[model samples]
Target: MTRIQSHPVLGNTSERLRVPFYFDENLYEGYESETIAAALLANGVRMLRVHEESGTPRGLYCNIGHCMECRVTVNGESSVRACLTTIENNMKIYSGQQLPNPVKRMVEQE
Candidate 1:
């Protein structure tokens, strides 16, 4: 599936910049102003991440960045809100399954 060609309210999306980006190492095109979630949806990629604890499949919910459901890893960073991050050319997106390692504080033996 391709991006929305035309909408009743917002028409003529051709003017927007169509840049290529990588989602899970796969290349896909996305508009400049489009968010990461929008870009993924355009390429028929609904499942972006999974719940860390339950391992449940997840995707876009609130596209306003308020919800963390759309969280994805942009480049090397993790827990980035897909709805808030705009797509850029050659941006490498990830599912954020392997989150950043937490800082471990070494404790003295009691």
Candidate 2:
């Protein structure tokens, strides 16, 4: 998917540097200074994590780092906020885990 063509409030995102990052082993690029969740959403990735008990998929909710729905693993660190975490070059992000355990994806029925 393509990045945001132009943001009404932010103007043009093309001015920022396109940082390369890995999400679930897939290569994606996002503008510099943009949050990890923002980048992922722009690239059409909605599922960010899974519930520990229910095994349900979770994505961006309160993008201000309060909802705790966008938690993801960053560089081996667990429970990192995707909405507040900045996207860095060569960063690795992974979902599908409830803390340390891999849970079923949101699309799965069983």
Candidate 3:
């Protein structure tokens, strides 16, 4: 069920070469070099992480990397933004963690 069997606009999907990776603790298959967000979306992943204040669900808003909405931790580091980061074999991604209080304060100051 990891494949988008059907898409409204993309239509009856073709098989994507499976690349192994883990998100949280679940194993997912995606194609190499594809954006992590795109691969996740194709597999019907609607929530990448939750907002800190409201704990509301959020996912890719702008497929492009400009918006931090699709941000997720990769390989123990939060530096790699998912929308811009390409999926690689054996990569680990984490989601739904709050920003550090200091970072949150900095954002509020801006």
Give lDDT tens digits, candidate 1, residues 8-34.
775668876778999888999888788
Provide the TM-score for each candidate, comma-separated. 0.81, 0.81, 0.72
In terms of lDDT, which candidate is strongest?
2
| Candidate 2: C-alpha RMSD after superposition | 6.2
Note each model's CA RMSD in angstroms: 4.2, 6.2, 5.5
Against the true structure, candidate 1 reaches a TM-score of 0.81
Residue pairs with backbone overlap in model 3: none
Q: What is candidate 1's local distance difference test score?
A: 0.82
lDDT of 2 by residue, 1-110 (tens): 56667888877876778899999999998888989998999889999988977778888888998889998899889889999999999999998575433344544646
lDDT of 3 by residue, 7-82 (tens): 6875554545668888888888777667888777767787999886667888878877787888788998875678
Give the residue spans of candidate 2 off by over 4 A.
99-110
Q: Please list all clashing residue pairs in model 2, or write none if there are none.
A: none
Worst 10 residues of 2 by lDDT: 98-107
